[model samples]
Target: MTQNKLEKYARLLVKTGINIQKGQTLVINSPIETAEFARMIAEHAYDVGAREVVMRWSDELSTKMKYLHADDEVFDEFPDWAKEFSLSYSRKGAAFLSISASDPELMKDVDPNRMARQQKVASSALKEYRERMMSNKNTWCIASVPTAAWAKKVFPDVSEDEAVERLWDAIFKAIRVDKENPVAAWEEHKRNLKNSMEFLNNHNLKSLQFRNDLGTDLEVELPEGYLFVGGSEFTPKDSEFPETEFIANMPTEEVFSMPKKTGVNGIVYSSKPLNYRGTLIDQFSLTFKNGEVVDYSAEIGYESLKSLIETDEGSRYLGEVALVPYDSPISKSGVLFYNTLYDENASCHLAIGKAYPVCIKGGENMTSEELEQHGVNESITHVDFMFGTKDLQITGVTHDGEEIVIFKDGNFAY
Candidate 1:
């Protein structure tokens, strides 16, 4: 890409994606492999008159090594400064940019359960931080950086540079950078998705269904006036304003919402593997009753998954249940995006971690304790796994036994 093109991408991140206002602090979470792009972001943020640009980088290999060797005590002890930093950031208006594209498989050797538990404990230390991030509401956007591992996953036969090029092309296409007017394209896209949401809201359907050859018979109840949110940008911090980012549209074609915390039932087969805390749970199946996961099986990482479900009372219940038909842009590209930023957007999925306050009616203002009472799952982790398949069919039903087709053959119907 030319410098101008690169600059355009950066500008898009600011003007279009995050829509950074003057004097906003930009916190960018990136990997060292993407330091070049991070620097470009700093420059672009400054160009857009940002107050400050804070960049944090993580070495995936080093983190994995730590997980392999760290003592149990290390898992329980979180740095006070880290907690303070989280709280401080939450108190202010800030913009967050997450650049992934790291090797999702990098943490494969680390114990997933241990890592998951450690994260939960660590976040517990930063309770205020968590609250502020969620309740205060911040503006944030997630993008990715193509690393050697991600590149290798995409193109096993190609060299690293070639793989990176291909990955970049995909990113460009997924974000609509190839469009003559990318921002305009995103605006139109968001408008289209909003129309879908409006339709679902008008239906006022009570429950949603998913059926497929894999025996997915699940029902997710919707609280009254529950909004279907997609294709929008959000504030990462307290003071930052909101802008629409990437239309929140993934390559997948599922319009999703959070089911009533106490309403999910039936069994779901994860058509896609779940990589959590460096562990990949392949061929996973979970059974839910009364909104709690009662049964689960996986070809691999079963122990880790078991640990996840047992984390907290709300862990067994879901926070966000999303549907993505196989027709997603990522799926259409026929790429197994190891990164969840793309992968989660690629397929219909469910999260077992913290519930989005926005997902529940009047949830944004609810106290954590109150939310718990409502059966809203709360955890530091929000891991998503795919459940949508080609033969899957979904029907939305109301309390009166009215049924409306939502998805069929891995695509949205009506």
Candidate 2:
């Protein structure tokens, strides 16, 4: 991609992705492979009057090496300084931007148990930071730029350079950065998503029934006062910038909400591969009873899937339910990025683990006990897996006992 195009992409992330405010601290978490793009984002942020910019760089290969060679006990502990690093910035009202571009199978050979242990430890230590983000206490966004390994994974048949170029093209188009006015394009896209959010919120939906030829036959109940959120999200009234509005995920096409902690039942099958912590889990099916995963099986990465479900007590339960049309832009591209940040936007999906508190009415201020009373699931981890397909159908049950077709043949009905 040309430098001009790259700069444009970076500008969109700063101006619209997190909507950086003047004199506000900005924090960026990025992969080392995308250092140039990350630097571009930082420069753009500073140009927009940011008070300070903090860059946290990570390397997937190094992470994998640690998981493989580090002492087993190392995975069981999270450093206090690491926890403080995130907390200090978040508490000081930092707007976070994360670049997501990792090789999907980088950790395929590592022990799933080691990764699982480390995940649990980190989640526990950073619970406060995680909660803040989930409630929009901090304005944050997750976007992506193509990395050589990721690009090659997405287009293995092509040369590395060609693959990277192809991935960049796909990313630009998906995020609308290829448009003449990318920011304006997003504004229009937001308006379109708002329509769906309004439709779902207007109906007092009690539950949703999902079915498809993939053998998915599931009924998921919505928690009381649950809200379908899409497009831009606003920081809570008590947040550092109460009026700040940000898009949490770039190229997002799903309207999502929390599911009742103990109200999901039946079976659902995966429609696409899930890239979890550099591992790919594919061709999986989950059996839910009372919102908990009673049984699951995967043809690939079974151990990794097992580790994910067993992460914590709450990991066995469903926390979020999201809807994405099969006809969406990312879906139309016909490219499976194998990255959740992109793949989840291409399909109707559900998360296993913690629910977003902001998805419930007045949830941002709710106490843990109060949130539990509202049937919100809580956990250290949240993982989304795709299950949407062209043949899928969804029906919503209203409080008045009326059955309404929310989705027909993988797209919104009405």
Candidate 3:
């Protein structure tokens, strides 16, 4: 990619993605492979009067090695220091920017149970920090950059350099960084998404029925006071930032809300492969009865899928339901990214485990028990899997039992 475009992308992330304010500290969790791009973001953050920019670098290769050779007991424990590191910065009102660009199959050969154990332990340790982010108590954004292995997986026929170039072009277009004014472009995009959110919320939908030729015939119930949110999110009025708005996910195209903990039933199929911590799970189908997965099967990476579902009791239930069109920019690109960050935006998807507290009315201030009382599910994990097809149809049922077509042939019907 050209330096001009890279600089523009970096600036858009700083100014629009997180909307960093003057004198606010910024924390970046990024892969070491993208140090150059991360540094560019830091430079832009400093230019906008940031107080301090903290870097937390990760090496997926090293992590893979550790998973391969580390003791079994190691995965069962989470260090208190690591937990403190996250809590301290989060308490100080730091804005967070995470770069998601790991290789799609780095852990394919490794045992999925080990990674699952470590995930459970770390998530338990960082529950407070995770809750803060989920409730929009802190400003946070997740974006991606091109990595060699990721690029190669997305475009296997091309040389590494050519693959990376192609990936960069696609990323720029998806996030609107290719436009002359990316920030303004995002504003217009936000308005478009807001229209969708408003339409869903105004409908007072009590349930949604999904059907497709893939044999998916599922019904998901929405909580009584659920809310649909898309494009941009705001820190709660009583949060440390107090109504400061930020984009949580760059290149986002879905409007999402929480599903009732025990209000889902029927079967759903996967439309694309799911890359779960570097392991690919493809051709999977899940059968749910009263919001719990009763049976699931995967043609590939069945063990990984099993480990994910068996993580905790809450993992067997649905947490989030998101709507995306099959004709979206990311979907139209015709690339199977193998990355949930991109693939989830290309189709309608659902997440298992922890529900965002902000998805319900007065949720940000609700206690854990109170959230549960309102049918919000809570867990240590949140994994999204895509299940949208071109011919899929969605019907919304109002509280008064009126059926309205929300989606027809995989696009919004309004």
Candidate 4:
């Protein structure tokens, strides 16, 4: 990829992804491996009127080293400074932008339970930060970067440099970074997604039944007043950042909303491998009863899968259900990026734990207990696993018991 094209891509992210506003502080959470690109983004953020740009550097190797060497006490510790630092950023109205690009097998041998425990502690420390995000009170965006290790995972047959370029090109297309007018294209794309979400919300869908030959025949319930969000967080009612809209995830495709915590049933299989706690969980099927994952099996990462379901009481139930067509750009590319940011956008999926407050009517203002009473889950984690395929179908049942096929053969039906 040429430097000019790369810079243009960076500019697209700064201008259209999070839409950095004048005098706003833009925080970039990225790995040290992508320092150069991160710096480029920082420059572009400033050029777009950002008051300050903060670069938070992290690396998988360091984290893996910690998991391999840190003592048990590290798993339970939640430093006050760590909590305050993030809180300070949110408190200051900083616009956050995180980068994801790590080798899928980075934590191939790490202990899943240990990682879960450590993450739980960290999640607890930043619970308020999460609250701000879920409420859409703070703006944030997540975009992918191309790293040698990540490129190697996506393209095993090519030289590392070639793999990187190929992956970059694919990502550019997926995010519309290569559009003749990227900003305008994204505006149109976001409008289309919003229109889709509007249709779902207006349908008053009570439940969704999914079926596939992979033994997936699950039914998920959606509470009244549920909302679907995708592409951007700018609902008609949102008055935040009116000048520049908020895009939560770059390359976002799925129109997602909260599923009633106790309203899911049946068995469903995962369509793609999920990289969790540094472990790759693939070929998994979960059985649900009353919205809780009662049983699960995986070709690999059984322990990791267990850690996820058993993380907390809320973890056992469904939190978010998302719909993405089988023929989405990311899906048709025929590459498994092995990263959730890309993979989840390629297919239909669901998240366990921590429902977004934006997904329910007045959810953004409700307390955890209040949300729970409405069947919206509350937990410290949210993990998404894909399950869309060529033969997958989803049917929506209205409150009046009228049944309508929402998805047929993995494509949305009008």
Candidate 1 lDDT tens digits, 137-220: 766666776777788877889888898888878877777777778778777877877787777777768888877888888888
Listing every candidate in turn, what is its Cα RMSD in Å to the true structure after a full C-alpha superposition?
A: 2.5, 0.7, 0.7, 1.6
Estimate the overall C-alpha local distance difference test score of candidate 3.
Answer: 0.94
Model 2 local distance difference test score: 0.94
Per-candidate TM vs. native?
0.92, 0.99, 0.99, 0.97
1-414: candidate 2 lDDT, tens digit per residue: 778788889999999999999989999999998998899998999999999999999988989899999988999999999999999999989999999999999999999999898998999999999999999999999999899999999999999999999999999999998898999999999999999999999999999999999999999999999999999999977788777989999989999999999999999999999999889999999999999999999999999999999999899998899999999999989999999999999999999999999888999999999999999999999999999999899999999999999999999998
**Model 4 misplacement above 4 A:** 235-244
In candidate 3, stretches whose alpha carbon ends up further than 4 angstroms from where it belongs are: none
After superposition, the stretches of candidate 1 with alpha carbons farther than 4 Å from their true spots are 1-4, 233-254, 372-375
User: Whole-model Cα lDDT per candidate?
Assistant: 0.73, 0.94, 0.94, 0.88
Q: What is the total number of backbone clashes in candidate 2?
A: 0
Q: Candidate 1 — what's its lDDT?
A: 0.73
Better of 2 and 4 by lDDT: 2
Instruction: Find the number of clashing residue pairs for candidate 3.
Output: 0
